[model samples]
Target: MSPRVRGEEQPGFFEVLGTWLPRQPWFRAPRGRLSLTRVGGLRLPTPAGDSDSRVFLELHIFEVAHQDGPVRISVPVALRSRPSAIAGKSAFIGKLTSPEHGELWVYDGAGDRAFLAAWIEMSRREQGSRNGRSRGRAHAGFAFGSPWTLELRRTGADAPKEGVTRSIVRREHADSQGEHDRDEIVMDLLRRPAGEQDELLESLITLSEANCEVIPKVLGTIDGAWKQKDDADDAGYWVSGILGVIREAGISGPDGTSIMRRALQAGDDLSDSARAAGRAVGTFHADLAGSFGAHPQTQEQLRIMTANVQSTLTQQWEQVRSEFDDDEAADLNEVIDLMRMQLRDADEPLMLQQIHGDLGAEHLHRTAGDAWVIREPEGLMSHALGLRDVVTVLISAADAVMSVAAETPEILRAAAEQEAAEAEQEGQSDAPAEPVNFGQWYEEFTQAFLSGYRESDADSAGVDSVFFRAAMLTEALDLFRRWRGQWVFRPSMLLQVDN
Candidate 1:
């Protein structure tokens, strides 16, 4: 049905829209139909030289549900004078048949490369402002952030557009071509009109593939990518390649053992096995920080983010503080302080470098050879606090190990294998299996790994012992968090000590 064109409101040209906005993938609404707050006549922006007034119509859409609930995105629509004859095939935005206006089309101008390109190119010049700004050499690194963040009335943050169409980065010495090609696609997905769910789903799959690739090659190995196939498409990528032989030994994915776990599991607690694992993470942090420091962000940015982080921690702490006895609260407080102090101390003013931003046990990878690895820096904050990465990863990993350390090696291994298999069955994946206690089996594993990390010319060791203790504490606590219900913390740590 064609959308209705009002007879009295005739303005040389007419554009038609429908109530079908809520179903779009790009629509950030949890559920709802679009209500036209204002539908204005199109204002042409072009080289028409004041001759042709064929302006594109604009629709400012407010977020709403199917006549109910709330949506996360602000909908603004600028539709062409008439649905382009070619609108039906557009990938990001598409055509809609309207009863009032005929077979018209809708396009998210922001998603259109023509519309997004200029904004991105322009933003390339604005590197952030900050002090103690890393004076050493650094790569321009990545420039990215959450494009379409949800805001509620309580926070008073304005409802944002559904998504960012694209982000641009200009390096220390480079042209303004966007650094990450995949990001534009991601931003396009962000800025897409909510109507196209299929594009969103496809974009998500591509994003997952990118995360899988970021794993360090030592952990991922040449075969790692191949082993990481549970989905049919991923399986195809692996099998079609001649290197598919890697998948035969093990699987990969969330369902399977990750390279980090594999690397950690391969060792017995021979001397420095644990420390070797630390090196993997530390080295990753170092590289990430170095790359980021070269392109510093202003302190104001960190100040804003740290406030958000503090609010989250304070809320969590208050709940736990009330529940805990003195000793437990103290312990919790101590760990929490380790995390909080970084933000608090930075108040005086500090340098801004990139961090893994989202680090955890899952992101830490291991290989079959007892090679501890850090990976999947998903929240790879180019402008972030470096310590946050270390703190969060350690805390998260500790939470994991604390719970699982008590189980017998065999039981744990069997469970891991089963979980890996189940993940594969459900299209989840783990990593290639090596000796669960690789430290004992291979005497040189720890030494060799540390040697490689220490010898690397790319980075140097600058982490303070305080972070090491925090790392250890977090590692230990992870065990506690996991084992808290099944077994007492002491029993597990005392018994099935992780090598």
Candidate 2:
């Protein structure tokens, strides 16, 4: 075994990481030099059979402490004896000579196909055991479940005996994990430790399995460094979640946002898909409420949620308020005022329940089976008014319309500016016209979605005009934050609300 002591000449791992980490987009660039510590981490083994036995894949997480606060960064490294063997040039970190392993060439582990395959195998088998050894004092445990890896592997082996060929062909894609079939497993290594919030995914997965088909089957989750922090020594890499990869079941389709954009551009009817998506969302929300149950919103809880939303809006608006003109700013103020008023008084106590927190056409996939499957739930994912989901989706729809509308004017303005410059010589000029009839499909899309919700027999008690107006206004504030300086698009459809 390698020396269990961390500082014992481990080829200056921390020094190499400090040099390579800031270049990564996900790792926030510190204001000053970063102070890194190898708190703890876990590893996924290479597949059972491989051509090269020397290659090793490990995810080393660090607690990057800056003046602001301590943030975690997980680095997946591919350790090889031959540095030249790693193909990707950008994946190369610095080479080092470990006392135990010797002359190790390290590259970003995410680039390795073997690393990806190992994670997929773990998820497929649902192997949640702490069988692997931790390099340091950290005691990391791997927990698997949902479909269970054994079940997935058995599905492959038992196919012939069942007189059927598993139609889901293996078509691998690149990301954290590598190869995947039409339907496979994906493993996401969370940068931070698993907290109470992490439980939301597993809860939703279990509840949705019984109530609806909206979510992909959760394969399993692996909790790293599962122990109470006795002191600074107890800190370690905390948690990682893995799940079954939802495959495209639809005959052919684009992402939810792209479809909306196409429908707007072509003036194509999106009523059917819109309605279906809305229904899917409504059913999912209903299932969440039914399976997990909800509580009546206390006055204190309402106040806290309202304050949090208000504070966020204030912060984002401060950054972008200069972009709006007098009239536009006033209009935005009215919206904020409306939101404040709505939150101040409620006709009845709102029903609080768990929801998919993040909702939009983009986060949804139309499967080959023509059913809508949701992916990527953001925020607490635990309990809140179901209307929060409704509000977020509505905002996303609005943002999509804004993005399409914003594109045309930008194109025309550039053309007009070019023409005006040439016309200056000829003493003739024409300004580009502003886009009219903005958000043309807004009403249709909103109605279709709501109609689906109503059709799903979801309780309407929590939904009211006042609540909806407040939701819209709040979402508008969220969007307004992006309108600063040069009107850069803040793809709301792609943004996950962080609570």
Candidate 3:
């Protein structure tokens, strides 16, 4: 057996990290030199009282500086006695000799099975603190808040996503004898360090505490911080937390975008689905307002919204025009001019609220159990005009419907030609094709979605039609740029300016 290394006798950990940090996907600095500083980290409980057990789990925070600026990242470090004991080949960090522990194998904690289980346990217990010798100091650190209040019933193994984050599933069994069970826990870890508390996620957690249906239940939050700038030693950087994964009865169903695309492809009626999505969004907004409270739509807020819309629209027009022919560009310019004029007329004040700033078909999910869940608060506008969410959803849906419809005819024409060619080869008749009534479906979906939104508890009476139309134009322009980049849009999307 080897003598254990005292805190002061430990090897230069950052020396080895300098070589390994660049290999991670979350390492954002351009391929060049990096200067590192140990900020802070937390310790996870390891097996106790086993002389042969030499495994340790530690999260290390480092401030990496490059030409641009300094970026903070959290690296979960796993120390093991042997290379063979490392969980995976990809998890390997570097091998180093410790004065007291002898030789040790280092691995990224995210990939280690023991680390994942330990993290779940720590989060469940709300245990947090700093550990290990950093910056010539030897002391154990503790988390900022009280013990975690939420409990996950069960946790399933999960793999890290990309190199940035990882997820663990919590399952709940069915009460009925023959009914199936489903996952309820969704633990998320941000590989890099966060500057402060995430207000949006915090709001969701609060709503979950209140038993809100739209937002996912926040089981618990785990964060690691280190003293950085202040003279007083304080926990600073936020690391990770656990959330209840929003799913329809354990089934993470397809998003609204995929569902709408399916209906458009099959020429099926999309009214019911679109209405349900709109209602879900409305319910989500209502819950947010009820939990966070709404703000009055001040004149300044209206101006900011309008100005932002104009600025985005103007920028997007440049990109959109580059992709169109001269005639199409001229037509688009005229539409842009009209939209700018409409923006000038948006003078009325309306109610504002915290909103899902990135609401779209893709950001929402519908389950087979007839439930809708807001997947994530990807973009949050704490004081946005409440109508912005409604307008954004409408514009996104309209753009999608129009873009798909416009392309379908050409696609059908090409398919028919291919079928004819095949038929000629076999000397047989071509198969009859089913016609898609895109306009009819579009109208139905548009009306139903808007109706559903208007019917929900979210305040909508003050939504000025002129403001709505202007926002729709701005959103349409951005969508045009996106569709053009993807080589999907015709002039039809631009025609939306007339509305």
Tens digit of per-residue lDDT, candidate 2, span 252-324: 2356888777766544667788788888777877777788887887877767766775666666656665766
Q: List the candidate 2 regions with Cα displacement exceeding 4 Å.
A: 1-14, 28-37, 63-72, 83-87, 98-102, 128-185, 194-199, 208-212, 226-255, 295-352, 356-370, 375-377, 380-388, 395-399, 402-440, 460-499
Q: What would the per-residue lDDT of candidate 1 be over residues 402-451, giving only the tens digit for each residue?
A: 33334346656786777678778887566635445422322243344335
| TM values, all candidates | 0.37, 0.59, 0.67
Candidate 2, which ten residues in sequence have the lowest lDDT sum?
154-163
> 130-194, model 3: which lDDT tens digit per residue?
44222111011112222221222323233234324544433223343211322334545566655
Q: Rank the candidate models, highest lDDT first.
A: 3, 2, 1
- Candidate 2, residue 263: CA error in Å? 1.7
lDDT of predicted model 1: 0.36
Comparing 1 and 3 on TM-score, the stronger one:
3
Residue 248, model 2: lDDT of: 24
Which prediction has the highest TM-score against the true structure?
Answer: 3
Best by lDDT: 3
Error of 2 at 367 (Å): 4.6
